[model samples]
Target: MTGGGAAGLVGLVLVSHSAAVAGSVAELARDLAGAGRLAPVEPAGGTRDGGLGTSAELIAAAAGRANRGAGVAILADLGSAVLTVRALLAEEDALPPLARLVDAPLLEGAVAATLAASTGADLDAVTAAAEEARHYRTS
Candidate 1:
C-alpha cells in the first residue's frame, strides 16, 4: 500500500453491467496511462450470480480494495451502475471520505482519471480530470 497524503495517488474503480466490460476498460485505462503508473484499478461489474447487473456490495468491496489509503474515484458505464455505486457509498459507513463517484463518460473518464491518478494527483484533482473528460471531443 502507498502512503496517504495530499500527493498520494488516488485509486480508481470501474463499474459496468458486464464484468468483461469493466475489466477491459481498466486494462485500456492502464495501457493508456502507461504501465505501473496507476494504483489499484479494480473492476466491480455483474452481480453475485454472474449475471449482467450491478451490485452495490461488489462496488463497495472494490472501493475498499482500491483505496490504497489515499482515496478512490469511481466511474460507471450506465446510470444503474452509477446508482449502485452511490447506494453503496450511502449505505456503507466505513467508506473513506475521499472516495467519490465522478459523473463522466465511463471509458473516457476512467482513462483520464487513471492518467491523473498515475501522476500522484489528489482525489479532487483526479475526479476533476474524470469530469473534464466529459467535454473531450474528437472532431
Candidate 2:
C-alpha cells in the first residue's frame, strides 16, 4: 500500500532471528536488482533493530503498503519467524494477509521469495517453491 512502486512486485520481507540474515537478504536483493533483477527485499533482524519485533512490524508495514491492495507474503527463518509474525498479526490487526508460511531452505527461501515476488509471483507459487525446497528434519 505504500511502497510497491519502489519494490516493483510483491512486497517481500526476509525474516530471521539474527539481523544479519535479513540484512544479507536485502543486500542480495539489491545486488539482484542491480543485475536487473530488481526485487523488493527488506531485512528484519537485530542489526536493523533493537526493539522487540519493532523491526518485524516495520517490515510488515512496508510490505503491507508495498503490496498495494494485494496481500504480502512473509518468508521467515526457522520456526521463530512464523511465531513472531503470528504474534504481530495478533497484536496488530492492520498487518497484510500472510499468504503462507515458508518452510524450506532458509536462505534459499528468502532469496527465492524475493526473486519470485519481484517478478509478480503469487504467494502460492513462491510459498510452494519454498516448501518444495524445504528440508527440515522431522521425526
Candidate 3:
C-alpha cells in the first residue's frame, strides 16, 4: 500500500512504455490517494520513453519494489505491454505469492483502481472492476 492507514489496503503499480506515462500513472494514483483513496502510488519500469515496455526481468525487478512488498495491481499501456506482462507471469519462478496480474484500462484502470483502493478495496476486487471498466475517458 501507499498510505499509512486503510489507504495501504491495495497497492497500485503502473507499467508503461514511456517514463512520462509511468510518472503520470504515479501522479494520478497519488491524486487518488490524496482524495482519500487507495494507497500511495507505486510506479516501476518505463523509461522516459518507456523502452522497457514489459520485459519479464524488468517487471520482476519493478514488482519487487512495490509498497507492502506483496500483491499489486499492474496497469499497462497497450496490448504489447500486456503481452510482456503475460510473459512475466509465465516466467520460471516468477515473483510468486506476492504479485499477481490485474488487467484494467491501462490509464483509466490505473486511475480507478488507485482511487478505489484508497477506499480499502481488495486487490482482487479492484482488478475485477478495472477489467470490467469500459471506454474510460482520460484525465
Candidate 4:
C-alpha cells in the first residue's frame, strides 16, 4: 500500500453495469499507466447474483480494497451506477474517508485517473484528471 500524504498516489475504483466492462477498463488503465507497482485499482461491477446492475456491497468492498490510506476516486458508467455511488456517499462511513464519485466518462476517466495516480498525484488531482478527460477531443 502507498503511504498516505500530500504526495501519496491515489487509488481508483471503476464501476460499471457489466462486470466485464469494469474489469476490462481496470486492466486497460493499469496497462496504460505503465506503473507496475502502482497502488490498488479495483473494479466494482454487476450485482452479487452476477446480473447486470450496480452493487452497493461490491462498490463499498472495492473502495475498501483500493484505498491505500491515500484516498480513492470512483468513476461509474451510466445513471444508475452513479446513483448507487451517490447513495453510498450519502451514508456515513459507507466508503473510505476520501472516497469520491467523479463525474466523467467511464473509460477515459479510468485511464486518466490511473495515469495521474501512477505519478503519485494526490486524490484531488487524480479526480481532476479524470473529470478533465471529458473535455479531451478524440478526433
For all candidates in order, the CA lDDT equals: 0.83, 0.59, 0.65, 0.89
Candidate 2 pairs with clashing backbones: 1-65, 1-66, 1-68, 2-65, 19-46, 33-38, 104-134
Could you give candidate 1's per-residue lDDT for residues 8-69 as a string of tens digits? 67889999999999999999998898866556788988997999999877888888788776
The positional error of residue 17 in candidate 2, measured at the CA in angstroms, is 2.1
State in Å the error of residue 25, model 3: 1.9
Instruction: Pull out the clashing pairs in model 1.
Output: none
All candidates: CA RMSD (Å): 3.0, 5.0, 4.1, 2.8
Query: In candidate 3, what are the lDDT values of residues 30-105, reduced to their tens digit?
Result: 7755764346456665643447555566666666655454356777777877777778777766654446667666
**lDDT by residue for model 4 (1-139), tens:** 2444424678899999999999999999999887455756899999999999999999999998898778899999999999999999999999999999999999999999998888778888888899999999953
Q: Which of 3 and 4 is the better model by TM-score?
A: 4
Q: What are the models' TM-scores?
A: 0.88, 0.68, 0.74, 0.92
Best by the TM-score measure: 4
Q: Can you write out model 2's per-residue Cα lDDT over 33-80, one digit (the tens) per residue?
A: 465535556666642446433355555655665463344666676666
Worst 10 residues of 4 by lDDT: 1-10
- Stretches of candidate 1 off by over 4 Å are 1-7
Candidate 1 least-lDDT 10 residues: 1-10
The candidate scoring highest on lDDT is: 4
